[model samples]
Target chain A: MAYLILKDLLLQRNMMLLAFAYVLLFAFAFQSMGDEGQLVAIISMVGYMFVMVGGAWEEKNNSDTLWNSMPAPKWKIVGAKYLAIPVYVAFVTLVYAVVSSAISLLQIPITTAPINVFVAALGTIGVFVAASLYYPVYFAFGYTKSRYWHFILIFGIVALSSMLPNLFPEKPAWIDPLFEKLPKLTGDAMFLVVAICFVALLVAVSFLLSLRFYGRREF
Target chain B: MESILELRNVVKNFTGFKINGISFSLEPGYIMGFIGANGSGKTTTIKLIMNLLHLEMGEIKVFGLDSRQHEQQIKQRIGFVYDDNHFYEELTITQMTKVLAPFYKKWDWNTYNRYIHRFGLPSNKKIKTFSRGMKMKYALAVALSHKAELLIMDEPTSGLDPIVRSEILDILSEVILDERCSVLFSSHITSDLDRIADYVTLIHNGTILFSTSKEELFEKYSLVKGERSLLGENLRPYLVGYRESQFGFEGLVTDKAAVQAMLNGNALLERPTLEDIMLYCTRGRAV
Candidate 1:
């Protein structure tokens, strides 16, 4: 598994470097503007791409049917991609913490909470959501073949989802009272539990689906 | 009788087309050639044996273990070299070598280094820059580096230069020197198989045409060339298929003694090469 990750990292070294740069620049921009949410989103997107490309390499698009012919099972193959996501998230989070911490100490409006844990936890949440949405699609169609279109499609999904509350007409007046009180009862706990459940379900389903698709695909 | 790999009544259906009941078994120490035309199931069978694709209906056993039940364990004992080369395009050969070596338990750096020298592959070069032959050499080198008891390859020499192709065949010959190791080589290039294969399994339209010893195929089947009018219905049972052109008729005849006797004092019966046999066997299916 380590070799698989290392091979894929080396395979996409330039893209990885570029992704890091993208996150760094985006983090700098958002942190400088005191916008932590957008910074987390950018870092999350970068990690998602890393796992997506990893999935593509595992499936082997440009090359011949070499990896597909290797004797590993469908679960181990999908498991490799999932394992890489958190590692990439950790790396990106560490980098963001370093740069953003400096900005926070300078009174640049960045939060000064117990830095490592808070940053890692928040970045992991974003990683979880983005991966939950992206992995199922990426596994459905092996990565390189669908990266561009799915990236665009995922953006549309994110945009439409974010706009739903504003776009949809108002719910009943009594419903607002429940919506307001719901946050009081749960707050981040609800979000965390829901996100964890959804991500777990998505990852499991993607793997099962990938295995089925792979069994039917020829070299 | 311990066979390294055995396929029994393997049937895979792809929508309208089908691979029906293709069966063959490779003895422990002999190299078996898998030959077929374009639409034949050479690669598909390899995939099924490798368990890359699910077997629709059949039983496959590898090293006495059920292919589906112990797929990975069987895989660990076998090395596969598919037609296309796949390594990290961005990684230099050095990086690829280091990263891929640890996956197999029997990985040998010394053997890998030897193959690199034997194939004349550069460790510093990125795989993306290597020529087709070079890439193939690297893939073969990796496949051989691990101490695998079985080697299953699909068209290991199809597009390579003759020099490299010959080198791969030589390597396979050496690999088969061990009494425990065997190979299942799938190829369209019958000449390569003819030169190295101990047995031959010919597949056509997803069906096994013949699975017999290479020497037996050459000895039993003879290619007869003569005038169409000179040939008669009496030879129909022996004729696998025939091509009738403006000049005359040519085809494959399985019974060498009968073919020679039938054309006595007339035409001639010559031993058919693997190519000649495959050509005639697949003649009717070309359209």
Candidate 2:
């Protein structure tokens, strides 16, 4: 199983390098806008392309028939994907750390310690959770073959959902107070809890979806 | 001994066309030629047995186990080579084998290398750089390296030189000697099958025409090139298929001895080839 996973990743080194290049470009773009935002974008783009589309692209590239010929269990194949996300995240984390250290050492104001670092890590997790939840939907819908349409559907929905909120705004209540008033918890603490729960919920949901979709697939 | 594979009432449908109720079995230590033309459901039936394609309605048993229920277990013992070249183009032959070897529990690296040398494939060249024959030899090498009990090949010799084809057939024959492994080799090239195939299965237009011994197929059937009146309605049922022209009538009939005994003239009873069967069978059907 490990061999299968390792081979799957290694065989597509070209695609991985391409994905890495794309992520780097996007990260730099985000950095120019706001260095704080770059981490999230870098993590999301890599997770989506590296972890999600990796297998999908391989299948479309006609490696699916070869993979299907192997004797390994389907769950082992799925588990390999689960293992791969952290490996990709770890790679991103190393890059983020190196950039942050270099910027701070150089006395560059662009690098913010602790808060920026924490947000970046959380954002990475948030993106991981997002891809984990959504990739299964892509798989269920056979997105490998229908990638052009799926690309539109995924990004278009994201664009529309964020934009549509202006048409119907909700009023905020009086109890929307700052942490300074209560001396109880900070905004950072609230974000921490939200990120953990969101990520955990996403992982659980993705596993359930995989089991559901996998049952019907002939391969 | 039990048969290596058995398909009982295996029915697969794609839209309106149906590969209807294909039932045949191959015993251990035999080379079974799955003879068919293009789109004759040879590949489809192989896919169904391999669990690459789902059976619409049928039971496929491989080595006495239900194929659907125990797919992974079944796949472990079966080595498959498809009609097309399907290896990663960028990877070298050595690199590709290194990647695939770990997936099989019974993979013997030494044996794989032996076959590689035997086939004379270059060790370091990228698969994309190899010619058609080299690519096929590489595939066969991969197929043979793993300790596979059953080899299911679909048109493995479509467009290779006669020498390369002979090399492949020779290796296949040798593979059978080791463990009595059964081979289901499908091809349009009857000469290869005739030279090596112990048993034969003929499929035409989605359904199997006949599945029997190679000797029986050649020995029983003959190409009778005579006149149309010689083939009367009384003898039409025995005639598998025929073609007519201004000069005379030529047809294929099974039960060659009966035909020869009936008409004593120069009713030529030539040895029927696989292509002859396919051609005669084609003539019977309306175009």
Candidate 3:
């Protein structure tokens, strides 16, 4: 499993350079999202770029034949992709930190997010949730067939994040009740615990689905 | 002795092409040449053995274990080389092996390095930069490093120059010298098989025509050439496939003795090459 993850990383080594460019690009592009929003955007976009590029490499190399022919099991192959999500998020966060420090040292005009444990955790979980949604489809149909779903997920997130406030000028009446109980129902520490559990459950379910889909897939 | 690999009535179907209940087996310590024309289900059958393609029906057993149920166990001892390079071409051989070497139970870096050195492969260069023969040698080096008992190669020699092809054949010959290893080599290049294949299994149109010892296959068929007038109705049954020309006639005959008797010293009967046998069997009629 570690070897498979390493393979993805080696293939994406050049992407590390591209990631720095993305960090600078997203920092400016989402300047209006504020520091926290820019952090999440950078983490999500860069991390997910790693995920999608990994899949693209597999398709380009037609490497299913290689993996399926070897002793590596389908579960490990599918599991590695999910496991690499956090790694990708961590790498993106690292790049963001370095960029942020450079801006502070150089006194650059661009405003970027300061890396903190809470928002980093939030970004990691957000990327995990997105990967959980993408992997089952990827494992089922492989990279080529699952590409449309990838586009939809990306576009759906972008559209919702950018357009939702304008779409609804006023919060729906039902949303207020859920918001009102939120402070009492959860403190920050408790929210973190609940978020961890929720992400764990979602990932567990997603892993099983991906294993099943990948098992049925023919190279 | 248990067969090294066995396919029992294996069947896989696509819209237009299907492997129609094909069955064959390779005994340990021998090379089985799987010969077929292009689009003749050679790669498909190899894929089925590797479980890259799901079986619609029938069973594949490698090392006397069901291929699907004990896939990991079976594959641990099985090394494979496909026609095309499947390793990440963006990485060097060193990086690629670092990724693959952990999957096998008995991987030996010393042996891998030995082969890499022997094959003259550049350790630092990316695989995409290597020529086709170099890429193949890299694949062969990887396949041999794991102490694999069974090596399944699909068209590994297809496009290689004769020198490289001969070099690969030499390595394969050396691998089976221990009598614990076996090879199932699939190719359209009959001459390569003629030099090394102990057993030949000819598949045509997804069905195996024959699987037998190389010596037996040669003894069973004879390439005969004689006067066009020597081709009489009585001699027709003796010819598998024949062509007539302005000067004389040539054909492949199954019964060398009977053909020789009928011709009564008028025709020449020579031992047929594997290529002649494959062409005659598949073509059924010569142009």
| CAPRI grade of model 2 | medium
Per-model B-chain TM-score? 0.95, 0.94, 0.98
Which residue pairs show collisions in model 1? none
Model 3 CA deviation exceeding 4 Å by range? A166-168, A176-183
> Which numbered prediction scores highest in TM-score against the true structure?
3
* Top-lDDT structure, candidate number: 3
Name the weakest run of 10 consecutive residues (lDDT summed) in model 3 chain B: B278-287
DockQ of each: 0.50, 0.51, 0.91
lDDT of 2 by residue, B193-274 (tens): 8788999898877888788988888887898888767767766767888877877678888888788888776577788888
- Between prediction 1 and prediction 3, the one with superior lDDT is 3
Q: Is the docking of candidate 3 incorrect, acceptable, medium or high quality?
A: high
Residues A38-156, model 1: lDDT tens digits: 55666667776776666666555343255555655566655666677777887666656666667667776544332444445666766666665566556555566667766686888
Cα-based lDDT at residue A107, candidate 3: 93
Please report the TM-score between candidate 1 and the true structure.
Answer: 0.87
lDDT to native, each model? 0.76, 0.75, 0.92
| Candidate 3 lDDT tens digits, B102-183 | 9988999999999999999999999999999999999999999999999999999988999999999999999999999999
**Rank order (by DockQ, best first):** 3, 2, 1
